[model samples]
Target chain A: MTAVQWILENLPQILELTVDHLLLTVPAVLAAFLLALPLGRLAVRLPRLREPLVGGIGLLYAIPSLPLFIVLPLILGTSIREPLNAVAALTLFGLALMVRSAADAFGSVEEDVRLAAVAVGHSAAGRFLTVELPLAGPALLAGLRVVSVSTISLVSVSAVLGITSLGSLFTDGFERGIVASIVAGIVMTAVLALVLDLLLVALGRVLMPWRRPAPRRAGSREPAQVGERGAA
Target chain B: MTSLLEALDWVLTADSWTGPGGLGVRAGEHLLYSLLAVGLSALVALPAGLFIGHTGRGRGIAVVSTGVTRALPTLGVITLVALAAGIGLTAPMVAFIVLAVPSILAGAYSGVEAVDPQIVDAARAQGMSPRQVLLGVEVPLGLRLILGGVRLATLQVVATATLAAYVGAGGLGRPLFLGLRNHDYAMMLGASIVVILLAVVLDALFALGQRLLARRPGTA
Candidate 1:
């Protein structure tokens, strides 16, 4: 069948799966970020906690998702049929990735910046909120973008365990041997992921204006140096 | 603790190491699949990245490709390909290549771009060809990053290749999948240990390689 014809015919089903894909990713990534922020901060604040906090999560990230997905139901005493299995599995991965990125984000904050904040009569909590987190925005947002995009992709994996999502298209397509459905699923997933990534990039620009390139004159561009701090 | 011990006991048993579907055989299949995928990924990405980095072009392509590759769900790709190809090791290998190429490509180009221009200029002043400069200077300087990306890709492919079992392909995931299906926890734990151990070993081996490739600051 022609690709356009197939998409036109399956528009309703496709739209439903698209929603499923978004539902699988959006809340899970937010939950992971919520868990990761404090844990990532703890890793930075306590030198002794760094290895276990970061390394342990990294190890958890290394565990295959399919097994983890299977094992979560066993471990959590939840039914395999429940949506919790997929959500928990994706959250673990997002949490794992975000912890390291969050630590790196906070770590990227300069000592001078902290001292300056303190010198300005800011309390510890106030300084962290007003100075440190702002400085860490670029790195933190970069990490979030990665985790969020990968999470969107990973929602497809849960289809194997029978959680209906855009990935179900691939599963059902294969079972029914409908090549058009599989291609449509692949195209839709790719478009959704790219759209989400671009959205995060745009959000980063809006939220962290300091990270964006400055408006320049139409002519007379200067190549001052490679890798120099952007004219921030 | 008891489950851990039980898993170790199960793994140690001779029967687990015997037969066509034995742990040893599975490990071999696992290694072969991962190696093939990594090798193929490096082959495709390294050249493209090298050209882009050397010529200072295709940055957009690199960025877009990496982003897209990172975002495409591997499980979907694997099952779809497997379904199309009618089952074999090929599906998982293709999926691994897709998973791996972007990192390797990103690493290669970024590694090249990171080379101090003065070094390249020096090579040019000394009458070295562009090829010679790429080979003698940029590649060695960038080898660490390139290998770092490969190492990361290898770890990922090793972990995810186990999903081959979902499509009726064989690997270390067999025991885990079957064990989960049949309520054989020992088999699950035993196989998981093997899988994790393999991943750790790959990680450590690359760590050592990165160290060995480390050139002293004053020397090449």
Candidate 2:
């Protein structure tokens, strides 16, 4: 059969795999952000804790995903067949990456701003909610968007671990020597990544309404430009 | 804890140290793939990044490509390339090179840009050529970020190269995947420790290298 015919016939399977991809990614990214925020705050509040805490997270991020996926089942005492292996490993990675970003996000809040909020009789929690969170919005959202893209692509990787996310198409095509399937998997993955990226950008715009084009000034200062977040 | 002990014991075994699939050979393969990818990527990306940083053009390409590259799944790239290219190192090479390129590109360009413009002006005022300004003024100061890119790319490739086992490139991933297949938790954990150890060691070495770079420019 021709490539188009094969893809046409397998449309349902591809769509199902896309859903699996989404399922694996969404929770992992959400869990990552939730976990990373506290760790980031802890690192920042206690300056001495910053290096080891952030470094530990970066070290975790450095572990190979395949090995982590294989070993997590054992670590969690679950069967290799469980989807939790993929989710847990991915979540750990997502957290590892996002921690530094989150810390930097909180650090982006100026000390004067904090003092100004205090002058208005705002409680600490109230200041964090009303003042810091909004100012930190761009970095936090940008960090999430980067991690979300990373997670989406990684979810397909779980296919080799026998989870059959969008990545299954690659394996299926390779095993059968069907070029269309592999090509379809690549195209679909790209499409998924692009779509998800757009959604995240839109979400960021809605949440952070003040991020409009600004005039570039001389020596325009920017806080540390984290890796993979140049756009933000 | 018992499983962890068993894994530690497994790594100490003499049998595990020698054979076609021994940790030594696998580590070598992992190193080779990571080095090949990072080295090739740096070669192309550094010069291009420097040019872009120096001329202040093509920044958008670097930024956009980095995003797109980050979003493209590494596993899919490996599998697709492996299938089409028919196994061996070709698959992993393509994947790792693609994965590593964006990082080195971004790091070098941004690093150069981060250099103090005043310093470049000083170099020029001292009758230095543009090339001299780049090499003498920009590169040394921006070395940190340029090296940061390499460090990040190396770590990424080291981690990702484990997929070599899946695509027939033969790295440390063998033990982990085979262990999974045979339900040998000890072997899986042992192999993972090896991969993790490699990552930690490499990261430390890079950090040390960065420190050395910092020292050199200051002393000079």
For model 2, the DockQ equals 0.46
Please report, as a residue range, the 10-residue window in candidate 2 chain B with the lowest summed lDDT.
B211-220
Question: What interface-residue Cα RMSD does candidate 1 give after superposition?
Answer: 5.4
lDDT of 2 by residue, B31-114 (tens): 988998999999999999988887777888889888788877787788878877988899889999999999999999989888
Docking class of 2: acceptable
Residue-pair clash count for candidate 2: 0
Q: In model 1, which residue pairs have backbone atoms overlapping below 3 Å?
A: none
Cα RMSDs, all models: 4.0, 4.3
- Where does candidate 2 chain A have its weakest 10-residue lDDT segment? A223-232
DockQ of each: 0.41, 0.46
| Candidate 1 deviant stretches above 4 angstroms | A1-10, A43-56, A71-82, A202-212, A217-232, B1-9, B180-189, B215-220
Query: Which ten contiguous residues of candidate 1 chain A have the minimum total lDDT?
Result: A223-232
Please give, for every candidate in the order listed, the TM-score of chain B alone compared with the true chain B: 0.95, 0.96
lDDT per residue (tens digit) for residues A1-232 in model 2: 9999999999999999888888888889999999998888788789899989888887887777776786676668876567877889899999988999999998888989889999999998898888988998889888988788788888877777689788899878877888888888888888987888799889888888899769898667654432312221
